[model samples]
Target chain A: MKYILSFVLNGQPVDVLAEPTDTLLDVLREKLRVMSPKRGCDEGDCGACTVLLNGEPVRSCLTLALSVAGQEVMTVEGLSKNGKLHPLQRAFHEHYAAQCGFCTPGMILAAKALLDKNPHPTREEIVEAISGNLCRCGTYQEVLEAVQAVARGEYAEVKE
Target chain B: MGECIYFAPTEIGEAVRLLAEYREKVTVVAGGTDLLPKINYYQLKPEVLLHIGRLGLDYIKEADGKLVIGAATPTSKLASNPLVAERASALAEAARQSGSAAIRTTATIGGNLANASPAADLATPLLILDAELLLTSTRGNRKVAINDFFVGPGKTVLEPDELLIEVSLPHQKGKSVFLKLGRRKAMTLSVVNVAVRLEMEGAQCKDARIALGAMAPVPLRCTRAESLIKGQVLDKSLIDRCAAEAVAESSPIDDQRATSWYRKKAGTVLVARALARAADMEG
Candidate 1:
């Protein structure tokens, strides 16, 4: 069945027709062409499809499009404002967090959700936050450092 | 192309009616974490997708000295809830380790129970807590004990017309702990999981409920072990005996994740650790 889903995407109002079986990841990548959220695993195992639904990080690949109606959906593309990257994005670049850049968007968004909720999260908490995301490069230590840097507010003005 | 129909019911009554009407053709979805994955894997192909997310069922409330968790309440909520942490520490711990943060944010407790994975993390804690599950349909509402909720893997006693409404756990004075032996620390399926709740009378074990997961077709309670520790002091001998008894209760299979021997060994270790932690909390 066709359902009209109206949601705020990256600070912009969006109304799209989505099938019930179509995942939010499919709608984002196929319909809207917001291709930042990649289709890596297509399953929830790889955090490649991670996006913020109502300001909380969730695997978009497993999220049905109809379930997100009326909620605020934030993609990695929405993380920046006025051509400025989010602090976590800058931290990733400064700390060389991304290797092939495939898992970058999801990792950054997951960190964004964590830092927003807990600005001073511990190392264990940082690891727990990105535990769902899998970086095949196995750069967990560098990724952890980058997230910790942003949480400490050390890179707050890096994008500016 | 034929498309499946979708129904989003804002009210519980409407949801119940929709389920009744759709019957076998419908599947209820809350967070869509488990259901969507199954659907994508072609394990489930329902003609109608009934979305219950709009029913405002995502809540954890304490009423009448019971912690009532709505079926739609996310794992992330349960993991962070102070009441769950204090009253049902095992449940909170299980929720914390269920999946990744993103998966937990989307995975609902009801989905976990309904999925009926023998290794389901929440099942062990709920079993130890003696939690009651409420199932609602257009006919009426009925409550079933968590132990009786599952029949086998990926199966439950839920009727086609019934929807799981909430899970109510009694507020008890005791110490509880949950331990999971997964392949890795995070995002790994359990090889063996254990939950132990100890009611202590000044260091003497008054009562114990030990639940083991992934070691059988359904998450099971080691009643023999529970009986062994009743009215006895929780010392090394008792812990060892109970651990051995817990291992005896398991009928683990040789699956890809683990072997039967390894599962039995891990079950013994988890039971001991869970009991020890519960005893420590009592002390």
Candidate 2:
């Protein structure tokens, strides 16, 4: 019932032993201790478990750990390099996108995936990209602004 | 609960063999968007999880004038595919309105069909397109019309040993439209959905297909409404009558999301809007 899964996590290669019943969110948060991806709703309703699978945003809570073998999986913890935050992270801070901060990591990662594919997404595009993420704090207006700011390259060099 | 085994087969033959070997003990996972939820809700428990994501079953192809979509093809792919947009506009529209971007990126067309939810957004469009489902097992492969695929709510004619392979949509020259009435703009289940495909011959309706969802036990085509519209001039009176017929044909139920009475009224509105769009009539 155990399988060896080798995948590229963030920017590093990782090989982990996984059970078939283990979800990606569980492995990421419990086994790997990469807790950026939260387990808000284990049933994929909350976007608190969003992560990038092959540069596309997906609900890690719904993804099976075995299904991610040989695929590139990126978590919110992988968004920074050399202690520097990603542009979207900085934009969130600058634009006050986070209120409760529980949905922040997932929102930022989802926006990162969108910006990676579309560097200059319009306001409507930004709205569509983050539609999966739910910010119960009702910070949607600010989240939209933060993502738009990053898309406009306004927060490209902001410090963490 | 006992430990479950996972199998990722790269080839269709291997997948078929695994399904045959496991039978009722195995569940095929494509996107996991639906399956994982069911598992989390304790609605289903399988001893084996067979992943078909790596089986090269995620491509959209055109073969012999039919649009052949592999079962594992994600809703996001269908929503953004240019071929789907051009040939099967209604399907593309359904894909676009299915769920949020993240859900769409992982939700497969096969899962949507296999789930057999009456509110499934893609079902009505596929029905309008005259789609056929290709199912394979170790025994053999068989194709069934989309209309015949569903037996009831959350149920399909698919056997436990069979895995859905592909969905083939006939190529038709016409304009098609899909309209869904949900609770909210995004990530909301359909209260009522309608798909209309109209083949026009200089303003007169040459042929028409109308399919309604979330208003019956299974997504169904409004045959009487289609018959009334076919060969008739596209007009307000005709559209109203057809919408009424469509509403009359549905057997909606009262659920937490909506009431049967509300669904019938909304069904009429969706049908009218879809017919108007098919007729090139704008507000």
Candidate 1's residue-wise lDDT over B173-230, tens digit each?
7898999999998998899999999998876999889999999999998899899999
Compose the digit string of candidate 2's lDDT tens values, residues A1-160: 7888889999899988888878898789888899989889888888999999999989998998889988999987888788897788888998889998999888988888888888988888888888889999988999999888777778776553
Native contact fraction, candidates in order: 0.78, 0.81
* Model 1 regions more than 4 Å off: A158-160, B281-283
For residues B39-101, write the lDDT of model 2, one tens digit per residue: 866777779999999999999999999999999999999999999999999999999998888
Q: Chain A TM-score of each model, in the order shown?
A: 0.95, 0.95
Q: Please provide, for model 1 over A26-61, each residue's C-alpha lDDT reduced to its tens digit, 9 standing for 90 to 100.
A: 899999999999898777999999999989999999
Query: Which candidate has the highest TM-score of all?
Result: 2
Model 2 reaches an interface RMSD of 1.1
Q: What is the lDDT of candidate 1?
A: 0.90
Off by over 4 Å in 2: A157-160
